[model samples]
Target: MLLHYLKSSLDDIDHLIDLTKKDIEDIKEANHELVFERTKIKNDLVKAFENKKSLLDNELIKMVSNNKGMDLESILNEEQKTLLNEMKIKLTELKSVNKQYAKFVVIVSEFYNTLLDKIFPRELEGYKKANRTPATLLKVRA
Candidate 1:
């Protein structure tokens, strides 16, 4: 019964790891969205001009153009920009957190495997040691 309870506990931990992995995936997706939003905002900041049009397709620029909101600026105000910039920074931080979460998931998975290995080392070793098993002969006297 104690062994069964321990196994159940490990299964619960595995489930927690699964849930944490999902959260990590969600953080990554949110980070991608934030990056895209930042790019779009920066592009809008510059796309209204002639020579600045080249920056739109580069996919590498980081700064919003100096052109402050004269006409198109009404679409997003200073407060909105500030909020988005803050969110972008937060998303970046979350990405770093997601990296740590990934490492934690790997450690948890490895720990479970180690525990299972300890419980069945011989069977595991046998599978690793040989691809084929030698046949055993039996002698019989009648």
Candidate 2:
């Protein structure tokens, strides 16, 4: 029973990691819709994982503690330990990917702001006429 729960939790983490990778791809493509979809999927997965964690902590952990006369570490067999370790590694990778995605977003935002500033100077008002000649017009010969 405890092993089953641990395996399920590991599977959930693997799925989450997969979704995060997809999210990174969406970010690279600048696909806002896909990113939003990925975010929703991730949020739902998180809620499911929370429920699973509650069950593990409240039921599986207690059962293992009572039967094995030891904590979770002592109860887990070699395979379960390996799965747990793999889950930890995947989680670390996910963290790194998320950090990279955040940095990409910030860089994109800065670029957009810079472009906006160049397009609409702060000194120019909506009613004010620009004194400078247009670049496109200057290129045309009379």
Candidate 3:
């Protein structure tokens, strides 16, 4: 009976290890998606800026040809202005979401490290000892 219980415990540990591996993989995938989304959002912002600049240049050229002396800012159509504002808002949102994703990744990484330490304690201990040395106290005599 005792032997059966020990076997079951080992099996449970194995299952937990597998689950932890899957969780780590999922976190990595989420991190990649966040990076990709951020890049895409940045690219979209650049494109929007270029479009806005082009519109302003065209308006300036039109004003110069017409001899009206109009400013570029006053020439933006309502729809174009709204689109630019929407893109800016989306860019800010993407940045915020990416920051949250980074925080989640850190949490997942910490959990993964904890699991690794439990599964391979000797290696984890060695790494911890090498990286986290105790601070020495210096005695100063005046």
TM-score for all predictions? 0.35, 0.67, 0.39
Better by TM-score, candidate 3 or 2: 2
- Candidate 2, lDDT over the whole model: 0.74
lDDT score, residue 38, model 2?
79
In candidate 3, what residue range of length 10 has the lowest lDDT sum? 1-10
Give the alpha carbon lDDT tens digit for every residue of 1-142 in model 2.
Answer: 6567667877777788787778778778888688787787888887887787787677655757577767777776788778767767877887887788788779878988777656553445588845443444236576
The sequence of per-residue lDDT tens digits that candidate 1 reaches over residues 7-73 is 3333433343444455556545554354444445434433332232233223112222333444333
Q: Which parts of model 2 are misplaced by more than 4 Å?
A: 67-71, 116-142
Tell me the RMSD of model 1 versus the true structure. 19.1
Candidate 1, residue 36: the lDDT equals 41
> RMSD of candidate 3 to the true fold?
21.6
* Candidate 1's TM-score: 0.35
* Number of the candidate with higher TM-score, 1 or 3: 3
Ranking by lDDT: 2, 3, 1
Clashes of 2: 0
Model 3 gets an lDDT of 0.51
